[model samples]
Target chain A: MLNIENLHVSVGDKPILKGINLQVKPGEIHAIMGPNGSGKSTLSHVLSGKSGYTVTQGQVTYEGKDLTEMAPEIRAREGVFLAFQYPVEIPGVSNIYLLKAALNSIRKHQGLSEVDAMDFLTLIKEKVRLLEMDEKFLYRAVNEGFSGGEKKRNEILQMAVLEPKLCILDETDSGLDIDALKVVAEGVNSIRSPERSFVMITHYQRLLDYIKPDFVHVLAHGQIVKSGGPELALELEEKGYSWVENKQAA
Target chain B: MTTQTASRYTAEYSKIETTLPGGSLPWLRALRSDALKQFSGCGFPSLREEEWRYTNVSGIEKNLFEPRLEPSDNQIDKDWLENYRLADCWQIVLVDGYYSAEFSVLAGLPENVTIKSLKESLEAGDGQIEPYLGKAVGIDEHSFVAFNTAWFTDGAYIRIPAKTVLDKPVQLLHVVTDPNRLAATRNLVIAESMAQAQVIETYVGVDQAYLSAAVTEVFVEPNADLTMIKLQCESEKAYHFGGTYVKQARDARFNHHNFAFGSLLARSDIHSDLSHGSECHLNGLYLGVKRQHLDNHTRINHLEPYGISRELYKGVLDGRARGVFQGRVVVAEDAQKTDSEMNNRNLLLSNDAEADTKPQLEIYADDVKCAHGVTVGQLDEKSVFYLQSRCVDEETARNMLTFAFANEMVTKITQKSLHDLVLAEVLKRFPQQGIMQDWL
Candidate 1:
């Protein structure tokens, strides 16, 4: 479903993602683990088509189409979703309104009529129940005055609503408590299907316990030095990235 | 036309002063003369003046318009009047600057709510009208104000009796229909002690190349509550100058909201006074596009102890338009326990668009809480990208973001229909700034 071939990326002349090559088939769950400044977040941003990133070399293909040249919204409508590391606080904009606009935009792009208010309410109620999120959160401004756990849960709720073909979770479990993390992980687990792919990025191995990955890649110094199964995450959690660092230094 | 310019203004001032109707008292005549003298002494403010630094009124001076002597009765369509009516309120329409009794409905007013024309109020010998007429906003402080005072022919007068609560809002529609015409209109509102009322004064025009000068005075007595909404949506070639002066007595509450979305060149002055234990909230939003210029100058005077005031004004400028905001809060001596906060935020959408914001606070009271902030920048790129990542196209994202910024003030409006109307007008004026070109 997704392919990255020798993708070299830079931020203001400093290389961040150096020759990253990865492939993920449908229904596959992939995890990218790296230490601090391992270009984990940068990879997610570039995949989401964020501006200000210089793609020096290589190409990215999504579903056999050129993904690097699409605008952020076009990529989003094409079923590519990125859960931001830090959710933005948009004051005075209601969460429900934003969700409705986003859903309608994607629907319109797919040659479907926009959903009415009643239908939208009915649709969101089911998602809210599945995610165990309170309906009251929809009335308030998006991410404004939200607690850390609420923000993370809100991102999961958005993912459930969007139902993207390829979902990239960036540090989704960073600020969540045990209960919140489990709920978020369950939310992700429920959306797992054969036709959809998941790319989870994290610095810790705890989130992997809830939704096990099929493939785990170690990223160090802007390059993926090792690829293994779920046991690699446990190995890094037990030992640390110091071994990877020393190997890169050697 | 240099020195003779003074005589020209003086002649225009004297010509209107002598023609005031017979119901006007001698004191009003003296006040008018004094205001005219002050105006003549100061003449027109130049761009060199610090207060007028960003605004250039050279065009206003070059094309001096003569004030209309009598109201015109041409092509006043009934559909247009109906279109201007606010939902579930008494609609008082003013045609070509004079109150139109035929189109106004005052029969369903509450028992204690008194609505009348200014001319009728003056002729009825209502002693309550004189003291608060020009007391809040002095004409001597501004040249256009003086010009309005010296020439205003007719205006709306509203008075809510003591302890009365008006359920329905009162709508005052000022419509200018004559092309290349100039009219000076005024509105006087008095909310008695413990009374509550909401008033919406809208200035609109159909004719291009016209000028409308308006001044509204509001008095909130002790324990009274007043909410005033001022909307200016004039012609594209029109020029507008409006002033709103408010006074809050002891323990009174006053809220003023101004929305400016039209006019080629528009300036609004809002002066609010909070007495002992009084409170005031002044919020404004202006959208300027396509060479439009909008300026807002607001001042809050905190007098006596335990007074409070809060102000927030935002502007969105695009297509070489300019926006200026100058907000000042003064806490006087003995006004201890005063709390005041003011903030001005602007969004510049185009390269040539400019925004000037100055939030100033002067405190003489020792015990007070006062702070002011100003920010001028483009839309947040991260926020834009965040919205876009949610499947909203760039145009929709930008429009939603800008609307959200202005909705901070629009949500404060209690009237739903009026709020929707103003929102539609704002959307039409801004047009999503081409962010939706691909989708369209």
Candidate 2:
């Protein structure tokens, strides 16, 4: 559902992504693995049209439309979701309020009726059960004083509610314990469909064990240097990123 | 030679000397005469004074709004008045500073709790109100108090006897009609020992320019509780000055909610003196637009040990509006173990809008826990982005965050009818198109 052609991006005067190209078909799950400072998070932010980033060269196409030209909200209304690594703590907005606003906005954009309060409550209750969240969490302020794992699970809950066409999981597995990781992975796996796509950005192969991807790509020095199958993650975990660096140097 | 602003008021008071209230009582006459002299000596407060530095009253000084001496129902709008009065409460209506028994509802009032006109009290004798008229607030506190003291012709007098509890709030409605009309009135509220009561003061008027100067004094006896709410939705072209001074006895509790939403220039003062183990809370929300200037001043004094006070005041300024917040807390030397917290926050929605905030804490006690915080800025861009990322457009996101900021104060109101009323007033101050009413 997403096509990147030699995407070269820069933040301010410093260039981050030198030349990167990737393509993911419908219903495919791609895991992008990289070491620290490998431009993994930048790729996700740039794809979601966050401000303060300049695309120096190349282009990104999503669902046959130019993605770079749309605003952050427009991209969201067009079924693009980015689960942030550090979710913002909004002090006064309720989690249920944001979820309903988002669902209604997307539904309105798709020419569908807004969900009634009763039906919306039922839908969120089922999703909340699947994510193992406290029922009281819906009434609390958005991510305010929430635990790290709770925030990650909330992101997954949002993804389930919006049912986006392209889900960009930006380090959703970070800071999560084993139990929380399982819950989040199961939440994602349950929403998978032939029309849905996912780009999971993670640093460890441990998350790959829960949700197997169709392809694993190793990103380094602002470029995708290696592309292989799910077994490639295990190979990197055993050999370490230094092995890939030595092989690229050679 | 003192000041032109003060001299003009002296001249205005002279024109209405024979028309003032409480002429039969020498004590009341002497108080009015002394207050007039004081007002003349100091004149209108100057910007050079610390308390009035940010607010300029030259606009008010230039105009002459004579106090309306008699009730004039010619310009009253019945339909418009119905919009502001709540249904589930006892209503006392005042039109142009005169008590209107025709518009007041006191039929189902409980026994031993007196809610009557100040005019009636003054005419009958000194038995009902002479003891607590000026006990809480001194006329020398400011020029506005002095003006209201010398010029007030009529007001509301409420008294709840000892051990009595009121199930419903008592609404004091003050409305003005004519242009350049002055609605100067005084209110006295007393809750005896172990009593509980709620009082709401609402000020509204026609579209013309007018002046409303009001002073309300409250006395809460030992072990009593009282909640006072002041809702000022004056005409956009009007000017307003109101002061609420309270004295809390040992173990008494007092709370105030000040909502300032109207007037071209408005200023509200809420001050309290806490006795041993007494508690006080002051919460306020001020919204300004279209060149409106709103100022809020609050003070809490802890006199004995174990007293507590909490305060939060917020302002939202748009268009070319300006908002000012000044808060002061004083802990006496004997007020050991006093715990107090004060906070002031402001949101500026436009480049032309401005907010000025000052918090003063004076502590002579060694064993007290007191903290204060202040902030003045636009909305957080990160929070806005967070909302926008959830599919809400930028304008809608901004509106939502702004509403949420003000909603914190709305949620503190326990009275459902009053809460809904205040929320509706808040919604009217914002752009209707930006906020979707159905979703809220």
Candidate 3:
């Protein structure tokens, strides 16, 4: 469903991602594990079409179309979701208001009718229940004064509502506790289908215990140095990232 | 600095002096004459003065707006007037600075409450008028106060009895019709000890280039609670000057909400003084579009110990408009434990739009908590991208953010009808899709 070939990304004068290649077919979950300053965030930002990052050389394709050329909103409407590492706090715009606007925009892009108000409410309430959140959260301002775990669950709830084709989780598990991590993982697992795909970017292997990935890739020094099965995550967690660095250096 | 422009208004004073209210009272006449002398000497406030530096009143000097001698219903538009005359309240309508009895609605008003025209109150020898007049604010405070005292023809006089709780708000609606008409009015609102009441001052006029200057003095007696709201939606081509000065007794509570949405050039001053253990809250929102200029000035004085004050003012300026906010908070030496915070935020939507904000805190008490903040900026780019990622286009996202920025102040109004009315006015200025009133 998505392909990244020789993607070289730079932020201003500094090069962050150098000649990266990754591929994800439909219904696949890929986990990218990295230490500090390993360009994990750079890759997710480039994929989501965030500004301030220049793709010096490379191409990213989604459903056989150029993804990098699309604007952020256009990419969003085209079903490419990026769960931010730190969700923004919008003080005045309510949570339900934004969800409705986003859903309507996506529907309009696909030439579908706007969701009925009653139906929209039902769908949102169901999603809120799935995420085990209070109904009052939908009426409050978007992420304003929300706890870390609540913000992560809010992102997952949004993913459940929008039902995007390709989801990119950028450090979604960093601030979540064990209980919140289970809830978020359950929410993500419930939405898993043959037509959906996910790319999870994390710094620790603890999140992998909740949501197992089909394949694991160890990213270091701006490139993937090792690719293995789920057992590789346990080995890395036991031996530390230095083992991977030593092996790759050898 | 005095200017020669006051000669024009002074020259025409003889024609309307006999027609003004309370001409038969010697005390009133002496007050008017003293104010006229002050106005004649100082003229209108000039830009050289520290307080009037941001605003220039040369426009008033250039035009000679004459006041109507009597209340006239010849050009009154009932349909348009209904837009501002709120329901379920006692209303007092003033047209061209004269009370219009035909358009006022005061049925079922409490017997203890005194609600009538200031002119009628003066004619009936109601001794209550003299003590409150020029009490909260003196004519020497500025030239505008002197001008209003000298030229005001009529206004509403409201007094809620001691220990009385008003069932409904009192609406003082000010309207003007003629193109070059001057509407200068003086109002007095008094809440006796232990009383609670709400008052709303609404300003509207026909589509013309006139002048509307009004001064309202308020007194909240000991332990009384008074909430006042000023909604100024004057004609776009008109000029407006409104000042509300208040005095709070010991343990009194006062709240003022100022919403300025219309007028080509407008200036409003809201000043309050707090006594021992009293509390005061001041909130204001000004939206300027086209070439409109709106200026809001506020001051809070903590005179005794344990007084508290909070002030917040927000402005949205678009096109070539300019919005100004000047806020000052003063704590006296005797006012120990004074808690005060002042904030002014402005949003400039266009390259030509401008916002000038100044916040001053003068504290004499060494042990006091006083803080102030000011910000003049465009929309937050991170917020814009956040909305854009939620599938909102860049333009819509900007509009939504701007509307939300101003709506924060609108939601502070608790009265349903008034909140809806003010919300409609805000929506009319910045119309955005998906901004349903139900959602708010």
Candidate 4:
């Protein structure tokens, strides 16, 4: 479902993701763990088409299409979703309004009829209930004044709404408590299907206990030094990325 | 040759002054003469002037404008007027600076509510109009205010009797339909002791090239309450200059919401005098797009003890547009418990767009609460990504988020029809393909 070939990215002139290559098939969950400043977030940003990042060399393909040239919105319409580490607080837009616009945009791209207000409300209400999110959240501005757990849950709620083909959860578990972590993971797990793929980026293996990954890739200094099964996450959580760095240097 | 040009310029003003309307009341005649003198001395405020630094009023000098001599038979289209007409209220219509008796509807006015034109009020032995007509604003300081004071033909006159509560809102509609002509109108509103009222004023223009200058004076008597909402949506090529001067009596409450969305060159001046124990709230939002320029200047005076004031002005500029906000709040001596806060926020969507916000506070009282804040920047990248990541395109995401920023002020409008009208105009000026359509 997703492929990255020799992707070298930089912020300004400083290379962040250097010679990175990875691949994931449908229904597969991949976990990328790295130390701080080890290009973990940079990989996610570059994959999601964020500006201010220079792709010096390499290409990214999603579902057999070149993803490097697509704008962020086009990538989004093409079923690429990024759950931000810090959800943005949009002061004046309600969450329901944002969600409806997102759903309609994707629906239009897919040659489907846009959802009406009533149908949209019904759709979101079901998802909100499924996520155990408060219905009042739909009325308030998107993520404005929301607690940390609420923001992460809101991110997951958006993932559920958009139902993207490829989901990238970037540091989604950083600020969450144990309860929120489980709920968020549960939300992610419920959406796992054979036709969908997910890339979960985390520092600890706590979130892996809920949504286990099929592949674990250890990223250090902008390259994947090791790749293994879900147990690699627990091993790294125990030994840390320093051992991976030493192994890569060797 | 140089002396010849200087004499020619002086001769032009002399020629123009003679053509102005004359033979009014002595006091009014004297006031107009003095104002004309001041106007001649100042000419047009150049960009070199500190207050006019960002605003270029050379357009006014480019075209020679004559005060509207007579009301035109060219009536406003009923459909267009109907779109702006507020129902279930006492309505007053002023067309081309003259009260339109044919279009006005006044029914079921409470016994204490007084609504009339300035002419009728003056002729009907009402001496109250003369005392507060031009007391709040200095005509000598502002060229447009001076011009409005000099040439105003007639305007709406409203007076709420002491201790009276006006259950219904009073709607004032000012319409201009002539492109080549200029109209200056003046309004005076007074709410006596313990009286309460809501005033909604709508300024409409039909011709794109016409000019409209207006001044409104409001005096809130002791313990009275007043909420005034001004909606300025003129033609795209029209020029609009307006001034609103408010004076709150002891323990009175005065609130103003100024919404400006359309015009080629528009500037609004809002000044409030918060006297002893008075409370004032001023909120404004200016939406400018394309080549439009919208400027708002607000001044609040906290005079006497225990006066409070709060102000928030937001601007959204796109497509090489320019927005200016100059706010000043003054706390006078003996105003010990005075509390004042002012904030201005601007969103520039394009690289060519610009915004200038200057918040000024002067406090003479040692014990006071005064705070001012200003923020100018582009839309948040994280927020934009958050929306786009949801499958909303970049343009639509931007529009929605920008609209939300300005909607905070639009939703504060209490009247539904007026609110919808202003909201529609505001949305029309938003950047295309941004979040405007869905929320609007």
Candidate 5:
């Protein structure tokens, strides 16, 4: 479903991701673990086509199409979803309104009709229930004054609604408590299907307990230093990122 | 001492001095003369004056518009007028600065409520007019106020008795029909103690270069409540200057909703003086397109202790349009425990479009709580990207965010019909595509 070859990205003059390579197949879940400032979030941002990033050398291929040339919204229409590490809060735009606009936009991209108000509400009600989110929350502004857990949950809710072909979770478990982590993981698990792919970026191995990944790759200083099955996560958890750094240097 | 426009209006006033309403009354005669003297001395305020710094009135001054004294058979389309006339209310229509009983509908009005033409009331010598007319707005404030006072031939006069609450709102519709026509109308609204009323002042005109100058003085007595809405949708070639001055007694409440969407150049002044324990809320929205220039100036004065005031003004400028918002709140030395907040936000859509907002809070009382904020910028790129990430197109995303910003003020209107009307006007100023008005 996705392929990256020696992806070198930078913000201004500072290199963030240097010679990074990754591959993901359909129905597969890949967990990318790294220490702070190890280009974890930068990978997610570059994948989502956010501005202010200079990809000097590399190509990202998604479904045999050049992903780098697409605008952020075109990537969205092509079923690429990024659960932002830090979601932006828009004061006057309601969650429901945004949901409908987004859904309709993607539908239009695929030559589908716009959803009626009543039908859209009915469609969102099920997802709102799945996330255990209050229906009233749909009427409020987009993540304005929302609690940290609620923001993360809202990102997952968006994922569930959009039903993207590829879902990229960027630090989705960073600030969540134990209960919130479980709920977020539950949301991710419910949406897991053979046709969809998942990329989980995390600082800790705690989220692996729920929604376990098929493979884990340890990222150090922008490159993947170690790759293994789920057992590699346990070893890294026992021996902190310093061990990984020392191993890479040696 | 007077410039061309100022002395021109003064000269026009001299031509019809004997025919102007209240001419027989000595007090009104002296009042008009005094106002004319003040206007002649000051002329049209130049940019040198602090209040008129941003707005230059040379356009209105260059053309000497003659005040229309009679209701001409200008063939006003009834259907066109019906668009502005709200349903189920007593409407007082002023056409070309003349009271038109034909266009006005006063059916089924209550006896306690006094709704009539200002000229008629003055001719009938209605004793209620003397105490409230010119009571709130002084003639020496500016040239526009002085011009409206000295030259206004007719307007609306509504008096609600104590404890009387009208079932429906009152609509004061000012219609301009001729080219080079000036409609100088003055309104006097008096709500006695415990009275409640909602009044709407609407100004619409032909697609011609005309001038509409109006002044309204509202007196909300102790414990009374009054809500006033001003909708200015004049022609693109027209010029407009309107001022609404309010004086609130102890425990009184006043709310103002101002929408400025028209006129080649438009300026609206809303000022209120709050007494002990009184509360005031001023909300305004201005949308400018093309070469339109819209200016909104507001002032709130807290005279006694325990007065509260809240103000919010938002502007959207596109297509080389310029919008200006200047708001000031003053807390007197004796006005302890005064709570006031004022905010002005502007969105400039195009590169050439400009917005200037200045918010001022002057508190002489030590115990008062006052805050003011002003912002002028383009839409947030982060917000735009967020919407786009949700699959919304960049243009649609921008339009949605822009509409949402201006819609805040429209949602403040609780009146359903008025809300829809104002919403339509606001939507008209935008491109009107890709934004789901239904969803909002």
Candidate 6:
């Protein structure tokens, strides 16, 4: 469903992502483990078409179309989603309003009619229940004064509502407690289908314990130095990222 | 040139002076003569004055707006008038600055509550208005007050008895129907000790060039509570000047909400004086589009100890519009433990749009606490990008953000019909795509 070949990304004069290659078929989950400054966020940001980052020399294609050419909103309508690590607090726009607007935008892009108000409410309520959030959260301003765990779960709820084809979770487990992590993982696992894919970018292996990935890639010094099965995550957890970084250096 | 403009108005004053209200009362006649002299000396406020530096009233001079000697017998579209009239309230209608007994809705009003025309009250010779007419704000405060005092034909007179709680709000609806007509109105609202009331002042007019200058004096007696709302949605070609002066007695509470949405050029001044252990809250929102210029000036005075005051004014300027906000807070020497905070925030939506904000805090008491802040800039880019990624197009995202910025102030209105009316007016001034009313 997605392919990145020779991905070289830089922010201003600094080269953040050196050279990376990745391929993902439908219904696959890939966990990218990295230490500080390993360019995990850079990859997710580039994939989501965030500005301020120049793709020095690489190509990313989603569903056989050049992903970099699409505008952020166009990419979102085309079914590429990026869950931000730190969600922005929009003081005036309510959370439910945003969900309706997004869902309608996607439906319009696909030449479908706007969602019925009652049906939209039903769908949204079901998703909110799946995420174990209060109905009041849907009416309140988006993420304004929301707890960290609540924000993460809100992102997951949005993902479930929009049902994007390719989901990029950026540090979704960073601020979540054990309970929130389980809830988020369960939400993600429930949406797993043969037509969808995911790229989980995380700093630790703790999140992998709940939402196990099909493959694990160790990213260090702007490159993926190791790729293996789920057991590699357990090994990395036991010995720490230095095991991979030192091995790459030697 | 200023003297020349003043002379032009002075030349026309003699034709209408004899027809003005309260002409039979000696004291009111002397007061009107003094006000006329004050207005003749200064004319309209000029840019030379510190307070009027950002605004120029030369347009009023050039237009030569004339006052209506009596309430016009012109037919008014009831459907159009109904838009500005609030439901479930006692309404006093003033057309071209003269009270319209035919259009007013005051049936079933409480017996003790006095809601009548200023001219009617003056003709009764009750002498009830003598103490509060110019007590809160004298003509010397500015030339607009002087001008309104000299030119006003009629206005609403509202007074709630002591310890009385009004069951329904009173709305003063001012409408201008003729081009080049001047609507000058003077209003007095008094809530006696331990009373509770809410009042609304609405300004709207036909699509034409005219002038509407109004001055309202409000008194909250000891331990009384008053909430006043001023919604100005005049014609796009009209000029508007409205000032609300307030005096709060010991332990009295006063709240004001100012919404400025229409007119080619408009200015509103809201000033309040707080006594011992009193509280004052002032909230305002101004939205300007096209070449419209909206200016809001506010001042809060702490006259006695343990007084509290809060003020917040937000503005949204689009197109070539220019918005101005000037706020000041003063704490007196004997007003120990005075607490005051003032904030003004402005959002400019175009390269040509401008926002000028100035916040001043003057403190004389060592134990007082006062703080003020101001901001003038564009929308937050992080917020824009966040919305964009959420599937909203760039244009809709910007519009949504702008609408949301102004909606913050609209949400504070407690009256359901009034809130919906103000919300509709606000939405009309901006792009409404993707901003559904049901969402709010």
Q: What tens digits encode model 2's per-residue C-alpha lDDT throughout A115-198?
A: 899999999999999999999999998999999999999999999999999999999999999999999999999999999999
Q: Write the per-residue lDDT of candidate 3 for residues B346-385, one digit (tens) a residue.
A: 9999999999999999999999999999999999888888
Chain B TM-score, one value per candidate, order as shown: 0.94, 0.98, 0.98, 0.92, 0.98, 0.99
Positional deviation of residue B12's Cα in model 5 after best superposition, in angstroms: 2.6
Off by over 4 Å in 5: A116-119
RMSD of 4: 3.1
Compose the digit string of candidate 4's lDDT tens values, residues B1-440: 12232233335444444434333456666777776666656665667777777888767665655556655688578888887788776899988777788888886677668887885665565767668877877777677777777677778999999888888889899888777567778899999999999998888888567778899999999999999998888887888888899989999999999998878899898999888999999999998888999999999989898998989999999888899999999888878989899999999988999999889999999999899999999988888887766776677777778888898998998777777777777766665723476554
Candidate 5 lDDT, tens digit per residue, B109-188? 99878888899889988777887778898998888998888889898998989999988889899999999998999998
**Candidate 3 global CA lDDT score:** 0.92
- Superior by lDDT: candidate 1 or candidate 3: 3
- Model 4 chain A, poorest ten-residue lDDT window? A94-103
Off by over 4 Å in 2: A239-250
lDDT of 2 by residue, B152-260 (tens): 9889999989999998899999999889998999999999999999999999999989999999999999999999999999999999999999999999999999999
Which lDDT value does model 3 have at B262?
91
Q: On lDDT, who's better, 1 or 5?
A: 5
For each prediction in turn, the share of the native Cα contacts (below 8 Å between chains A and B) that it retains comes to 0.74, 0.59, 0.63, 0.83, 0.74, 0.76
Tell me the deviation in Å of residue B287 in model 1. 0.5
True lDDT of residue A179, candidate 6 = 95
Q: What share of the true interface contacts does candidate 5 keep?
A: 0.74
| CAPRI grade of model 3 | medium
Worst window of 10 by summed lDDT in candidate 6 chain A:
A42-51
lDDT of 4 by residue, A95-158 (tens): 8877887888899999999888898888799889888999999889889999999999999999
Question: Fnat for model 3?
Answer: 0.63
Residue B249 in model 2: lDDT: 100
Find the 10 residues in a row with the least total lDDT in model 6 chain B.
Answer: B431-440
Global lDDT scores for all candidate models? 0.85, 0.91, 0.92, 0.84, 0.90, 0.93
DockQ of each two-chain model? 0.59, 0.69, 0.69, 0.67, 0.76, 0.74
The alpha-carbon lDDT assigned to residue B292 of candidate 6 equals 96
- lDDT by residue for model 6 (A94-152), tens: 99999998999999999999999999999999999999999999998999999999999
Quick one: ranking by TM-score, best first?
A: 5, 2, 3, 6, 1, 4
